[model samples]
Target: MGPVLRTEHLVSADQQTGEIASKIDAALTQLARARQIQRQCLATRHGLSPLQLDILMTVAAGEPPEPSISLLARELGVSQPTVTAAVITLERKGLVRREPLPPRRTLVRLEPSGQPALADRPFVDAASRLDPALQEAMLEGALVMIAHLVDNGTLSVARTCLTCRFHRSDGGHYCVLLDLPLARSDLRVDCPEHQPAA
Candidate 1:
């Protein structure tokens, strides 16, 4: 016979809620600190805003599709005008260039100047400057939460492992794109190869 279930072994709703809330708060705090560090680094070292840096990195990644205004807007979950504004600012800074396509569309690409900027310290590296254990815990929790939110459609700009087309689950979940096994802890909220599963 199957093992009998025990109601007493289950966690109470209040306990679960408290644990989830605490974890979320801790994760969010760490993420905000990391973002702050990144923003400061970009502003001080590169004379760029966080949005500008994000745009540059997205273009450099070259995933989902080519860097066009519409595509970028959709990927970033921002208005077309917001992306256009950032593109124009980046163009003025000589970091990005817009090439006119047929009809009314334009393609954006990073210029030579932008290449060096992307090589600078990223937030994850910056986070390492803090307490190792704290950083690791915060990042791990944040990744899991973000992945959950993305999978549930609460977050628009992230791609989750479980929802990607390349995800396989024979014995364990794995990504065929990378040809590597995936541990539950290894899942990411932002995988470049992630294609929305049909």
Candidate 2:
């Protein structure tokens, strides 16, 4: 060989691994502390548990102005009983109401008292702090992630066929919301940015 290669030319693998580990540890610690703060804030500000706040937010973001317990359970990745317990607590606090839908299904929605909590200043402040472009990018990324999760069976669609505005429950199959015919393939469609009429 013309010249001996030096081991010093190569970077230390251990150093690279240590850097990555440090980053990961920092991320986990931050997440844990944030979650603790979130819990405490909910308890102190709204007098509600974190799960109850989650349930309220889920209903507020749902398609039909309200969501069933099954929908909440699916969205939260929890058992029906867990959702039921949260709903019961929310109801006791007058934060949510369970209304009887036509037929037998029950719809859960935020009570008047809960609307202010749902529109909490902290969430608004955080959203306002984000750049519009960054917010849009984040929403798009979330949608992509949700699609991937559903495709991989890690997430489940929860809204009922009839409750969906795009679903044609009557004899004809058309979406009143879209003002077009409905396709069978679009049954489980959902959008986080969907807004209802004023």
Candidate 3:
């Protein structure tokens, strides 16, 4: 049985609320499209394909599964051949190198020359100008959306507090690993300590 709500005022069938939700969805889509276009621009500027730029950025983020072709394929949601082909292009450009690891795995390593592609993130630059309060609120909401995507299997991975094993919502927001209560502003989107919840 579904739990009861304290009031029916916010139900989705309400015209105003439904319209607001639709607007929010459209805004999010535009935001994503804008970011993708910006990345494509940046890719062209640096003479790299968007896929190569993504591979470099993934390596720079340093969160694991450590950038093997198969790992990158899964991480970037592309096929192994596609990642291999892109990696070849990146390698020829001196942006990355292939290293042999044990158990017959090939590790893709970003080189110093690859740094330029990972630099100049337009969204990060723009978001940095937001006021602290707005930044925190945006981050909190983004984590919630990311968590929802992960739950829906739209995203294979997220290293955010919402998907972490240590997040406790039984009482107030808390981090068991940190042993601290979280204010909305204290919520983290990509914590180094993040461990996925089972």
Candidate 4:
């Protein structure tokens, strides 16, 4: 028979879980601070605000049916006026263009002239010595965290499988749109093809 857990043992286990959770929270906080610093540095170096850089990065994808001001506001979790102000500045700098769409809506598109900085990814995919399995696990864990954030309204947008209409997972991951099987690594954090599950 298996050894029965006593009250003290259960309490000890609960404490351990809390302690581990605290440590993970602390580490995440450090990462957030580092990200803020990186964003500030990059934004200053390129003569743009952090919000402007983020907007540019989002639009740099150059997807069809270009993002409108309202969509950008919703995606970025910011007010419409804030996004509109940023878009105006970006347009003045020739980094983006405001195109009129039907029914009195304006869409945002990249200028296609300058913006060498914003077009490229800010964070380099640094070489890691971690094993492939460990790396994949890390990626899966991060996506799971992102999904949780989206659920709790900490994040406004996440074009990931968790909310994607095309994703299906009975026991395995698959994409209906592409009609393709998805390995854990095949999952995308920010997919251009993502459509809301609703």
What is the Cα-based TM-score of model 2? 0.56
Off by over 4 Å in 2: 1-36, 64-66, 121-124, 141-198
* lDDT over C-alpha atoms for residue 80 of model 1: 92
lDDT tens readout by residue for model 1, 1-198: 999989989999999999989987897799789777866686668888777888898899876556899988888788999999999999999999999998989899889989988776566576778886776566556655776776688877656776677888886778899999986657666676778776
What digit string (tens of lDDT, one per residue) describes model 3 on residues 113-173? 9986777867888889999899988888788889889999988878789999999986457
Better of 2 and 3 by TM-score: 3
Tell me which of candidates 1 and 3 scores higher on TM-score: 3
Error of 1 at 64 (Å): 2.9
Each candidate's number of clashing pairs is: 0, 0, 0, 0
Off by over 4 Å in 1: 1-17, 126-144, 175-193
lDDT scores of the candidates, listed in order = 0.80, 0.66, 0.87, 0.80
The prediction achieving the highest TM-score against the true structure is 3
With a 3 Å backbone cut-off (N, CA, C), the pairs that clash in candidate 3 are: none
Task: Order the numbered candidates by TM-score, best leading.
Answer: 3, 4, 1, 2
Cα lDDT for residue 66, model 2?
Answer: 41
Residue pairs with clashing backbones, model 1: none
Q: Write the per-residue lDDT of candidate 2 for residues 50-169, one digit (tens) a residue.
A: 778878877877564248877667777789889888888889989888888878767897788888886554545775789877765554444444555555777556233333435444
**Alpha-carbon deviation at 44 in model 4, angstroms:** 0.7
